[model samples]
Structure formats: C-alpha cells, structure tokens
Target: MDVKLPEGLEAFLAAAGWGDAVIEPLAGDASFRRYFRLRLGEQSAMLMDAPPPTEDPAPFLRAAKWLDANGLRAPRILAEDAPRGLVLLEDFGEVRVREYLDQWPADEAEVYRAAIDALVELRRLPPGPFLDYSLAEYQREAKLFVDWYCSARGLDVDAASYSAAWEEVLSPMLPRQRPGVVVLRDYHAENIMLLGSLGDQGLLDFQDALVGHPAYDLVSLLQDARRDVAPELEAQMLDYYLSKTGAGADFTADYARLGAQRNAKIVGIFVRLWKRDGKPRYLDYIPRVWALLERDLAHPALAPVARWFDANVPAGLREAGGGSWQP
Candidate 1:
C-alpha cells in the first residue's frame, strides 16, 4: 500500500515553480501534518501537507514569518495556499541536534551551550502575537493526567483534588510570568536542526508557540522526552542560562515548577497518543518523562501536586502502559 499524496499537492508544488521536482515522504511528528522533500536539480524545498479540519498551516505561517523577521532561524516560507493546507518551505537539511549528538557525544557541552544561547537570544526579542499560557490553560493541560492517565489505568481517584493541587502549586508562580516571552512549546533536540557548526540551530514545530514564562522553553529543552539529557548537562545549561539572563534566585524554583507541569502534561499526552491516536510508540518515553516529573515534583514549590501524585498514581503504574495496558 503506497502512501497517497494529499489532493492537489502536485499542483501546489508545480504552482510554486517546483513542478519537475522529485518528492519523497519525510517522517512526520505527532500531529496530523505530513511532509515531503522536493528536489528539482539544485533546488530543494519542504512541502507541508497540513490538511484541515484536522490540521491548519496558518499558525505555522504566522510563527515562521515572526521568527524570521526577529532574526531567529525558522525555515523560510517560499509559497503557501492556506485554505488548501499546502506550503513550500526552505529545506534546512537533515542534520538534527539529537542525531548529531548521538554520533558526536563529545560535543554535548558545546552543542547544549549553543541551544541555551538561542533561548537567551529569543528572550531578548518581543514576543510574537500569540495567546498567553494562562492559568486556565495551565490547569487544563495539567488535568490531562487525570483525564487520560487515570481513566486508562482504571483508577477512581479524586479528580477535584488533583485540580486543586495544581492550582495551589501554580497560582503563586503565575505573577512571575508578567510580560512573558515567546516560548516555542516544543523546543527540544528533535525539532532543532544543526545549521552549520555547534551554535547554529534551525527551529521547527513552533506552530504551538505561546506567550509564556521563559523557563517553560528551558524545561522543554533540558528535560526532553525523546532524549535523555544528562543531569550534569541539564544543571550546567540551567546555570548558563541564569548567568546570561541574570534571572533572580526564584528562577530555579520556577524552573522546577514548570518542569513538573510540562512533564505531567507530556505523560498524559503520551497516553492519549497511545490510547486515543493508536500511536503506542510514545509509550516508550513515559518512563523517562516520569523520572523527570518525579524530579520536578521534589521541589518544595510542587509539594501540593507531589502529594496528590503520591496518593493517586501508584509507583508501579507510572511506567510504560500504566503497568497494565499494552500496545
């Protein structure tokens, strides 16, 4: 069975002046979006198939323009047909930070430092036009654990208490995010492209960008789901970021708090991907995320949420497949 190209994809590519290009299917992420690598002689571009109503390319377009205008290394958009959900984009060749580091483990410090530097640079810019990562949004995301994880594991826990715990833990930290920065919600190694040397990073998968606490993206980078960042490296990167930004003492606590929140969201998301979307491979990352979440929960800032977890989610069930359900 061959993978079918989206309707009108060929015409869209031809209209973008790459009519004779060779198209090759590219690996897609967790979203409904599909990608193709197009080559015509010396010219190459990425074709994004973000068909609606399950997918939309408008947000990607908006973030790409904003990032490029602000001196960030987002891919350049060559052409777009928003309603049809097709776009031609600059091909930022295949060297991703994760794969690169896997091959050259010796350069971890240099590469990670560059990633932190990119975050610092992003912090200096005015946030792009986007919705805030509001308290309601925070609570909504946090509840995914209870919504999907608990239900899947057959646990009849106190849902209201879980919500209350998150409220107690997160409310105080909300004010610290006043006039937040543009947080690329998925700023991890996989989405990062090694443009040239150690420090040159090309960004991707930023359609979910939001105006949120700066620490959020830092957590996303340091506490990645798919990759295991060393504890020492995570510490060095955190300190490096703080030294560069001059963030106050409270920043560490904020980082821990956000890490717990983000990790919890990811656990639920992975479960949802398995149970709802039929993508069970995401289950493999659960143990890693659980470890990160537990570490984050250790901070005093997360005591309330930590207590809730202690009482609700059993230690055995925290692993891949909720200690029962299998792919």
Candidate 2:
C-alpha cells in the first residue's frame, strides 16, 4: 500500500528544515487528502497533503487554531505551505479510541464517558468561525441518500417528497441553533485520539466544524457507522450527557432528527465514494448506517422523513446492497 509522494513535496519538506526525515505513508480516510508520518531521529510530525482544487488545508488550520486556543487538543501546526496544500503537524501518537475500545471492550463506558464530557464542554463554548448548519444544508445532505443510495439500489424514489420531508422535520430545529455551538461534524471514536488518558482526547478531522445543533455531534458519536455501539451503552451515554448539560426536553427529539439526517448523509456519501471515487470498501458500512438511520426514524420528530422512507424505500432494499452493490 505504498503511495507515491506528491510533486514538489521534497522541496517543501526541505525548506521546512526536515530534509533528512524518514517518510512513511499513513492510513487515509474518505477524502482526497493523504497523510505521511515524518520522523527526524527522535522527533515526529505528520505531513498532510490535501492537494489543491479537491482539498484544502486552510479550514484545517483554522479549526486547529480555534480548538487549541480553547484548550482542546488538535494537532499543533509545525509548518505550512497552504498554497501547495502541505502542512506539517504534531503527531498525536497511535492510540486511536476506536481501535483501543475494540481490544478493551470493558473500558467502553469509561471511554465514551470522556467523549461525551468533551461534547458537553463544547456546548458551553460559543460558536466558532464557521457557517450555520442551515435547514437547506440539512436537506441537501439528506438528499444524498436519494441521489446516490437509491440510484445504486436501482430504486427510483420520490426525490421531491424526500426533500420536503427533510425540510419539514429539520426546519423547527434550525431556530434552536440561533447562537449555535461549534459542532464537530465527525466526532466519532475513529476521529479521536486517546492521548495518555481517556479524558485527555485529541481531536482530528474537524475541518468541517459548523455552528449547528448541540445534539448533532452526539448523534455522530452514539450512532457510529464504522463500529457497533451497544444499545445499552448508547442509552447510558445519552442520559449522562443530559444529566451533565441539563438540556431541554426537546434535546431528545433534536438528537433523533439530527441522527437521521447525519446517517442518511453518510449512507449517500458511502455510496458516492464507491460509485464516484472508486472506493468500494466504504459500502461495507452501509448496513450499519442503515440500522442507525432506522433507529432514528422511530423517534416522533422524524415522522415526515419516516413516512417518505415507508412510501419509497422498502425495508428489504434499505440495506440489501452494502458490499455487493454494483453500479
């Protein structure tokens, strides 16, 4: 799985005073961005190659700065060549929460407690310098399921009804986001680094942070697509968060609504990754996401979107085309 170094990267690294470092390719996510670990004797840093036109390091840099400024642990920027889309960042080490939890399932609750506490802390802070997660954006994201997932499943759905359903459900919550908090759009176990202690977390992949509902990130965490979180654990964590924040009664409905929206978006995005980006492995997570989406749809707040699903997408077809689905 060797990846070729990007053009001019050597010159860029040399100019940054790391000409003699050893470079090793790192695991990449569902993006055009590539990462490499740079080791200079005892020191280490990560080189993020978010090539232009498709990916940009500007958002990452901004989000990192804000998180660091607010006492959160994001990778420290060692050096940057933003025009070339190259950034040298502090290596948060190899202890990922997702992998660690898999090996030590006993510590799941304790670890998730810390993650939930982090979210509660985030809600206490004011919104960051990002755009609102508006009703239109919510509609656009939910539509990904219709645009990619439906097409891949060979099921022609009522696209207009889908849009209206999302709008109807999401419009009320938009008002709650008046003085919105910073919602780390991807706040799952995989994106978190367990540095030293479970309470001490390192955040990653937060470039898409937005001023949105407080419950959105919570949904992202509890209703994870990559891993199966036990229903008991999910319930415990939700109660823990509610006790910590003293959030209003509407929080439950808001969490469910956002969960359905985010899960729908992920289902579509996974399909798009396979169909458009030639990454079929993402399809394996489709069934897991569908399960989460179905759970969310059970909430009363999601009645409209649930009706759309009932009328258009069949239960058998909803998750029948994950890994073996062909375009």
lDDT of each: 0.90, 0.90
Residues 1-327 of candidate 2: C-alpha lDDT, one tens digit per residue: 658998888899899899899999998889989999999999999999998989999999999999999888899998998988999999999999999998999999999999998888889998889999888788889888889988987787899989988989988888887799999899999999998997888999999888999999999999998989999999999999999999998999999999999999999999999999989888889889988888899999999999999998876675553335654
Candidate 1 TM-score to native: 0.97
Q: Give the alpha carbon lDDT tens digit for every residue of 54-138 in model 1.
A: 9999999999999999999999999999999998999999999999999999999899888888899888987779999998999
Which residues of candidate 2, in runs, are more than 4 Å off? 319-327
TM-score of each: 0.97, 0.97
Pairs that collide in candidate 2 are: none
How close to the true structure is residue 284 of candidate 2, measured as C-alpha lDDT?
A: 87
lDDT of 2: 0.90
Q: Candidate 1 at 212: error in angstroms?
A: 0.7
